[model samples]
Target: MIFGSERQQHKILRKNHQMEEGSSHEITSPLLSNKEEELEDEKNEEDVVEIDENENSPIKQVALTVPTTDDPSLPVLTFRMWVLGTLSCVLLSFLNQFFWYRTEPLTITAISAQIAVVPLGQLMAAKITTRTFFRGTRWEFTLNPGPFNVKEHVLITIFANSGAGTVYAIHVVTAVKVFYQKHISFFVSLLVIFTTQVLGFGWAGIFRRYLVEPAAMWWPANLVQVSLFRALHEKEKRTKGSLTRSQFFVVAFLCSFAYYVFPGYLFQMLTSLSWICWIFPHNVLAQQLGSGLYGLGIGAVGLDWSAISSYLGSPLASPWFATANVAAGFVFVMYVLTPLCYWLNVYDAKTFPIFSDDLFKSNGQIYNITEIIDSNFHLDYAAYERQGKLHLSTFFAMTYGVGFAALTATIVHVGLFHGREIWEQSKSSFKEKTMDIHTKLMSRYKQVPEWWFVCILIATIAITIFTCEYYNDQLQLPWWGVLLACGIAIFFTLPIGIITAITNQTPGLNIITEYIIGYIYPGYPVANMCFKVYGYISMTQAITFLQDFKLGHYMKIPPRTMFMAQVVGTFIAGFVYLGTAWWLMETIPDICKDTSSVWTCPSDTVFYDASVIWGLIGPRRIFGDLGTYSKVNWFFLGGAIAPFLVYVAAKAFPQQEWIRLINMPVLIGATGMMPPATTVNYTSWIIAGFFSGFVVYRYRPEWWQRHNYVLSGALDAGLAFMGVLLYLCLGLEDVSINWWGNDLDGCPLAHCPTKKGFAVEGCPIFT
Candidate 1:
C-alpha cells in the first residue's frame, strides 16, 4: 500500500542515491511529477539529486527535507526549554479551549507557537545567566544552555502540539453540565481529562516499531513542520527578484492580520458571501439552493481564511490527490444525495430545515431533551413515550448514516489495500538487521523502556475503573464498560494509524463507538459519552503521539527526550484545558444557549445532540429495526461494497493509474464534519486547495515547495492573532457596529420549512 516489494525498494534506493548527487535543493519524485514535459529534464534531475548522501530514508520527501546527521551535544531539556515549553503549552491550551465555544471556532495549531518561540528561546539564551546551580554534583544544571538550538525548538513545538486542540473529554463535561443541566464533580472531570489524554501513550509505545521507526510509514503532514523548521533554522540563499521564505511569511502574516478585521468583526458577511441568496432573497427554494450556512451552497464562497480552514484544516498542507478525493465526496453528498433525499421528503424531511444540527420533534420544533431525563440522570421512558419519538433533520440523520459507512469502509478499504504491506511491516519490525538510517541513528541514544508505558497504561486503567465504579451514580458506566472501550481503542489503533500514515486522512470511530455502547448499555447519556471518548479519542490520541514521535525521528530529537516532553505536555495541557472550560462554564451566562452572541459553541452543540441521540434516546430507537429510518442501515453494506469494488477495479485496470486514487472512504466520509461544517467551509477549502495544490504546485514548483507550507502556517498565525485581539478588545466590551455588512449568512428563510402549514416562529408561514 505504501511501499512496493524489496526489488522496488532497491530500485527506489538506487534512484534516490542518484538524486542525492545533484546540485540543487529541490526534491521531486517521478511518481508524483506533474507537467514534466514543460520543465528542462537536466534542471529537474539536478533539483532531484540535491539530497544529502548520508540520508537513508526511502521517502523522497524525507531524504530532501530532514537532515541525515544529529549533534548529540545539544541540550534539549534545559531550564529555558522547560519554562518556554510549559508557557507555550499552557497558553495554547487556554486559548484553544476558550475559542472552542465561539461561533467560528478557530484552532490555532502548534505552527504558530513553533514560529513564536524561536525569538523567545533565542532571547532567553541571550539574556539568562549560564550559572550552574550545583557546581560539580550530578544534580548540577545551567539556566542558559549555550545558544538555543533546533532540538530545543523541536521539543517546544512538540509541547505546543500537545495543547493545540481542546481535550476531547471536555465535550462530555460540557454536554452534561451546560447542555444536559447536570452536576459533575470537578475531581471526577479532572480524572476523565487526564486519563483519556494519557491512556494513548501506552498504545503509542507498543506500536512505535511499526508506525514510527519504519522509513516507509512516512507521515505526510509532518513534512509541513519539517519544512518550516528548515526555513527557520537553516540559512537560505536568496535568489534575485524573489523573497526568502521567512520574508514571504512575514508579509503574508501582516496582510492576513490587517484583512481579518473585516470578516471577523466589522463586515462579517465576507465570511460567507451567498450572492445567489441576494439575487432571490424572498424565494425559499432559491435560498435553500444557495444559503452557505443552512443549505446546499451552489455558488457561495468565503473570503475569510478562518471560514475556509476552521473545520476542514488548512488545504495548503494537504496533497492535491487527497483534496481531490474530499472534494469529490463533498459534491456527491451535498449536491446530489442530500438534495435528492430532501426533495423526495424522505423521513419527513420537508417538515424541518434541510440543513441543521439541532435535534427536533417530528412536527419541526426543538426537542425538549430535559423533559425526558429523571432526577437521577437516567432516561424516563414514560416521559419519552408521552413526548413522542425524537427526530433529526434529514441532513443530520443522513450524515450519521454516512459516518456508519465511513467506519466500515475504512476497515474494508485498509484490509483490501494495505493488508499485505502491513503484515510484512509487522514482521520486519522485529528484525534489528532491517533498521533504516533514522532508526539506526536513534539506536545510539538510550531507548525508553517498554515498562514505562506499561506502568502508565496499568495505572490509568485502574484509576478509570475506580472512578467509574465508585462514582456510578454520576458516571453511570460500569468498570467492565471502561475495559470494553479500551479494547475497542486498542483494536482500531493500528488500522487507522496505517491509513493516517500514508494518506494523511484518518477515519473516525465516534459513530461506531457510540453505536456499540448505546445498544449494549443504553439510557445513561453520561455512560455513552464516556464510552465514546475512551473508545474513540484514545485511538486518536495514540495516532497523535505516534505522529509526534515521527517528527522527533525525522528531526533527530532523542527518543527519551520526546517521551518526557510529550508526557509532561499532556499533563499540563489536560489540567489547563479542564480548568479553562470549567471557568468559562461558570462565568458565562447562557453560553451555548445564546443565539445572538459569538459564544454559540457550534461544536459542543453537535456533541450534545449526539449524546441525546445515541445516549439518552439510544440507537435502537433511532437506527435499529424499531426506528423510522431503519433503511439507512443499508449504507454499512454500501460502504463495505464500494471499497471492494474500487479494489477490484484497480486490479482490473492496472494501467489506469487514476483508478487507484478513487479513495472510497475519503469520498464517502467527505462531509463528516457537516453539522458543524457548512457548505462555505467545503467550497472555500476546495478552491484554496486547487489554486495552491494544483496551479502553483504544477506551474511554479520551486516557489510552491518553499512558500506553500510557510504561507499556510503564516495565515493560521495571522488569523489566530487577529481573532483573539478582536475578541479581547471589542467583543469582550460588547462594542457595537450594527450594519447590513454584519449580516453573516443573509439567508433567514434558508432554515424555514418549505412544507405548507408547517409553522415556525420568525419564518413566513406558507398556507
Candidate 2:
C-alpha cells in the first residue's frame, strides 16, 4: 500500500472529519420542519439529473413509448365501430352533462371505455363477419371485417372522448335562464352551444402538421393511453422468477382498488388529517392554516390518491424538476405570503374569511350579485359602488395575480425556448421536409387534405355569423367580433398547440380575451362571453383535437377515419348535452338555486359569476389601474420578466444543466388552478410528487417503471367507479345519513376563520 506523507495524510483526515460533521448535521435535523424540508429538497434536487423528459430517469420507466411500426391492418371504421362508439359517446355525453349541474360535479374519465369496451368489441368481432350483411348495387357491407383490433379500439375510445370535455357554452345559456332570470329560445341556445363547442375542431385540423407530426412534441399525458393499449394487446414474454406485465398490472389494479376505499369513502377523515389542527383543536389560527377542505392546507396531509392527484395530474406523470419549482412557489405563496398578507390585512383581507373563492360583502356576508346587476345583464356601476367593491380571500386574490403572471409567462417561455425550433419546423413541415417513423407510417394512408379543414372552418364561421345576425339582440355580438374571435383563435392555435403537445398543457387565452372584450365591448355582457369563449375555448378545443390527431398518428390509425369519428362524435355530444341541459332545467324547480336535496348547478353559478365579474362589471372595475385590486395588475409584467431572468441565468451558467429546473410557466400555471383544486390539493400534490419522482425512481427503479402509470390508471378507475356508485345509489336517492360522523371531511374549525369576530351571514362563525 502507498502511504502519503504525514502532511498529506493530515489533509485527507481533516477533509473526512468535515464531511462526517456535515452528514451528521443533515441526518440529525428534524425533517418535519418547513425550513429543514426546504434545505433537504434543494440538496436532493441538486443530486438529480433529469426528470420525466429524460428517458434514462427511472421516473420515465416505460421503455416502449410507441410500439413497432407495423401495418395498422385491422378495421378502423367498421359498421359495428360506429354503432359501439356512438353509443358509448352518447352515454358519456349524457352522464357528463347530467353531472355538470351538480354542487360538486362528477367527471368520469374515458378510461372507462378504454377498459370496458375491449370485451364487448371482441365479442362482436367473433360473432360478426365480413360476409356481406348488407349489399347495395354499388357496395357490399359487413358488420365486422376482422377481430376487434387496436385500430378499432382506438377509434372507439376516440368516439367516447368527444363528450369527455364539458361543454362550456351550455353554462352560459343555463346561467342566463337559471341565475340571471333571462330566457333564450331552445333553438338559439343549442346553436350557440354547438357552434362554440365544435368550432375549434376546424383550427385543430388546420394545425396538425405543425403540432401533431413531430417526434419531440410528446404530450406526456397521452402516453398513459399508449401504455395501456400496449399492455392489453402487445404480448410480453417473461423469464423465470420475473413478473409478467399482465401479472404486475393485475396486482397493481387490485391494490389500488382496495386502498382507495378507505380514503374515498367510509373513513373519509383519512383523506385529510392535519396534525396541527388535531393538536390545537380550538385554535382558529391552526384550523385556518391546517385544515384541508376549507383552509389553505399549510401543514395538512391527505391520504386520498384522487384528492392528491386532482388538477395537477398523477404524481407519476409530472417530472420532479417541474414539481420542485411548483412546490417551492406554492409553499412560498400559499403558506408564507398569503398568511402574512391576510394577518396584516392586505386589501382589507382581514375583513373577510382568510380562505374562500366566493365574493364577500363588507359585513362578511355572501355578495348579492343579483342586486348589483341590471336587467340587461350588464353591471349597474352605481349600485355596485354603493354596495362597495367585491372582495376575495388573500389566497384567491393571489391566484388571480399568479394567473395573470402565468398567462404572460407561458407566452414568453415558449417564445424564448421553442420559438426558433417552431419557426424552422414550420418551414420544413410546410414544404414536406421532415418525417419521423410515425409520420412515415401515417403517409401510407390517404391523407385528409387541408381543404377539408378549410371547408369546415368556413362553414362554421358562416353559421356563427348567421346565428349572430339572427340573434343580434340576444347574442349582442357584431359580425366583426365574431370574425375577430375566430381570427384570434386561429392565430394562437399553432403556438399554444405546440406548447400543449410538448407540455400537456395549453396556456389559455381566457384572460387576454376577456381583457380585450371588456375594453372593446365593455357594456355588452353576452358579447363579451361570446368573444371570450370563441377566443379561448376554441383554442383549447383545437388543442384537444390535435392531441387526438397525434394519438391516432402514433397508433397508425388512418387520418380520414379519425376525421369521421371526431366529427360524428362531436355532433352526437352536442345533441346529447343540449338535451340533458334542457331536461334538467325543465324537470328541476328553480334548477340553479342552492338546494340541499338536489344539484344546484355549481358550474353554471361559477360561469354566471365570472361573466358578471369579467363581462358585465369588466376588468377595469376589478383589476385595472383604478380598480380595487389594482396592485395585482403588476403581475402581468412580472410574469413576462420572470422567464427572461431565468433565461439570463441559463445563459450565464450554461454548464449547470440544473438551471433548466426553473420553469416559470409550470410554477405560475400550478398556482392558478382555482376552481377544481385548492390549497390542500397542491400540498398533497407536492408530497406525492417527491415520493413518485424521487424516492421510487431512485431506489425502486423496476417497480417505478413497471407499475407507476398502471397504478395511476387503476386508482383513477377505482375512484371513478366508486364515485358513480355512490352518486347513483346514495346522492340521487337523497339517502340522508346526517350525523356528526357523516359531516364533511372538515367541520366546525375549518371554514371558520376568526377575523374581527367572523361572520358569513347574520351569525358569527366563532360563536
Candidate 3:
C-alpha cells in the first residue's frame, strides 16, 4: 500500500504492461513453426498432467539409485535377529525352489515363483516398515510406512530382500555345485554368490543415472517399489495411513502361510480353469468346446510358466518395455534363429522342431525332447550324459552377435541419446522422464566411477587366475577363453536383462552360453558351468537390481535409504538362501540327481564345471569327454552375426521408421514358432499389454499415473491371496483334501498319460 505513491504506482503500471506483452507473445508463439510445434506438444502434455485429478501429487516422485558408500550403521548387529531373518528367507527360498527345481534345474527360470511373490513381499514390507518402525524412529517424515505399520526395520528387510535373494541363492548354489558335480565346498558356493553381488552392485553404482532415470529404460519390476515408496514418503497425502498396505500385508502373510502348506503348487488354480468342462453342457463336443473356451479364459489370466494355451494369469509382471521387447526377442529367436537353425540342418525337424536336447544325436539341434525326459518322462539321465557338451560354434556365434549388437547399441544410445545428460544435463532430450530424475540425483551425489568397474574386472581376473592355478592341474583355461567368457557374460547381460525386464523371458542367452561352454571346455561340464553362471547370472542380477533401483527412484525414497535396505536384504537373503539350498538338496535327493533328476541342480551347473574341469583342467584320459569341444556348431554360431549386423544398421541409419514401430516382433515369432501350446502364454501377453497400456497410456493424468500402480499391485496381491486360500482349503495332489474337485493335473501335461493311465508315458503332475 505504501508503494502506491505516484512514483511506485508508475513502476507497477510499467511492470503490468510488460507482463501482458510477454503473456501475449507466449500465447501466440506456438502457431509459428517446427520448433513451436514441439513446444506445443510439450505444452499439451503439461496440460494433460494439469487435467488429471485422481493421480498422486507430482512433487513426491524420486529417482532410482544405489549405495555409493557403505553405510556405517547398515552393519549394526542385531546379529541374532539378522540370523533368524536370514533363516526365514532361506526357508522361503526352499519353497520357491521346490516348484521348478524338479524339472528345469539350474536355469534362470528358477526365479519365476519368487517373481510372483516379490510384489507381495515388497507391498507388505513397505506397509509394515513405514507404518511402525519409521514412525517410532521419527524417520517417518521421510520413510512414511504405508499401512501395516509393524515398525520393525529388520522384519521388513527380511521379507523384501529375502524374497528375491533367497531364490537367487538357491539357484546359484544348485547351478554352481551341480554343474561342477565334484562336490564343491559349501562355503565356495556361498562365496561365489556373495562376491558376485558385491562386485555387481559396485558395477551397477557406475550407471545409477542411466538405469534409475525416467529415460524410459523400462524395468517394470521396479514400478511396485516406486509406487510404494511414493505412497509412504510423499510430503502431502502422506500415505502412511492407507488401508492398501494393511490389505497387502494381510494378503501376503496369509498367502505365504498357505503357500507353505499348499499341496499342488504356486500355479494350482491356474490349471483348474481347463477342467471347467464338467460345469458345461455334457456332450463330448460341448465338453471339448467348453474346455477350449475355459482354456482361453485361463490363458488370458494365467500367471504360471506353462504353455500359452493354458495361460490363465500373468506375472503381474513385465519387461521394462512392456511387451515390445518380448516381441522382438521372440522374432529373432523363433523366426530368424529357429528357421535358420532348421535350414542349416542344425535342428532336425523330426526329432526336435523346437530346442534340441541330445546335441550328440540330433546333429546340431540344440534340444531333444526324447533325451530331455527321464524314464518316468520327467528328465532323462542317459540323454544328459550323451549331450553334456554343446556345439562351441553355435554358442560363441550367438554370444558374439548379441554382444556386438548390445555393446554398439549401448554406446550409441548412451552417447547420441543420453550423452549431454550424462555430461551437461541438456534439454530437448527425448527419454523416459524418470531417467532425468535419476541423472539429476546421481549428479548431486558422489557416485562410484567407471574406474570402479575397471577395478572389478581386474579383481575378477585375479580371482580367475587364482582359481585356474588352484584347479589348473585339473582344468587349465586359456586367458583368452576366460576373457571371452567374461566379455560374453557382461555384454549379453544388458540385452538379456533388458529383454527379460521388458518381455518376461529371453531364451536367447541359453543357447549363447551353451555354445560358448562347448567352444572353451568341450565335453567337460565343470568349468563350462561355472563360467556361464557367473557371467550370465551376475549380469542378470545387475540388471534386475537396476530395475529395482528405478522403482525406488519413482517413489522419491532417498537413494541412500533404498541402497541400505537392499544391502541389509541381500546379506540376509544370502545366508538364508544357503540354508535353503542345503536343506532342499538333503531332503529332496530324488529330485536333484546329477543326471535326469527333476531338481538336478541348476541347469548351468553341469555346463560350467564340465567346461572348466574336463575340457580345461582334466587330462585327456582322465576326462575323455574333453575332446568334444572340437565339435563346434560353426554354422549355428555364424547365424547370429546377421542379426547383429541388422541391429547395428537399424541403430546407425534407422531408415525404416515403421520397423521400429513393430517393437516386439520377436514375441510374435516366439508365439508362432513355439509349440501350439505356447499360444496360451502369447495370449496372456495381449491381456497384460491391454491392461498396462490402458492404465499408463490411455489414462495419462498425474493422478492416474500415481495411483494406477498401487491398483495393479492390489489386484496382484488379491489374486495371490485367493490362490493361497484355494491352496489351503482345497489342497492339491494327494497331500490334503481336494475341495475344488479331484483332478490334480489342472491342464494336462505335454505328453501326460490319459485318465486311465494308458495314453502317455508318465505321470501328469510336475514336482
Report every candidate's CA lDDT: 0.85, 0.71, 0.40
Candidate 1 at residue 496, lDDT? 84
lDDT string for model 1 (1-767, tens) is 13333334333544554465342433222221244223322231211111234547786656655655444546788887898899999999999999999888888889889988989988988899988899899988889867778888999999999999679999999998999888899999999998899999988888887798878788877888887876777554566787767788889989999999999888999999999889998888889889999999999999999999887778887777878999999998998888899989999899899999988888889999999999989889999898888887878988998998988888899899888977887776666546667776577688788899989999999999999999888789999999999999998898889777866778888999899999999888999999999999989999999999999998889899999999999999999999999999999999999998778999999998898889988999888876777888889999999999999999999999988888888889988888899999999999999998789988987677678878888888899899889989998898969898988899989998888886898777777
Can you tell me which runs of candidate 3 are displaced by over 4 Å? 1-95, 98-159, 162-181, 213-218, 231-269, 272-321, 324-348, 352-461, 471-484, 490-510, 556-568, 593-679, 694-696, 699-707, 715-767
Q: Candidate 2: misplaced stretches above 4 Å?
A: 1-63, 133-138, 238-242, 257-264, 590-592, 595-600, 739-741, 757-767
User: Clash pairs of candidate 2?
Assistant: none
Top-scoring candidate (TM-score): 1
**Could you arrange the candidates by TM-score from highest to lowest?**
1, 2, 3
State which candidate, 1 or 2, has the greater TM-score: 1
- Location of the lowest summed lDDT over 10 successive residues in candidate 3: 44-53
Q: TM-score of each candidate?
A: 0.92, 0.87, 0.58
Query: What local lDDT score does residue 501 receive in model 1, on the 0 to 100 scale?
Result: 83
Q: Write the per-residue lDDT of candidate 3 for residues 1-767, one digit (tens) a residue.
A: 13223223323333432342232211111112455334434431110011111221222221211111111112222322344345445544544444435432111121223234335444643554332344566443433222222112223432454443323334435643443333556666665556555445644654454444534455554555445433332223224544443244345445533442332344344532444444443332222222322222222233432332122223344432435555455446433654464346452222222221123232333333234333321234456556654332322223223432333343333344335654542332334343232344333344335565567657866676565456543333454555666676666554444444444444334334545555545544435445555555556556656655655444323455455555666665566566666777667655454454335443333333333323333323121344343222343333344345445666877876644433332332233222212333454555555556445545654443445444444444344444334434653333444455333223333222112222223333212
Cα shift from native, residue 282, model 2 (Å):
3.1
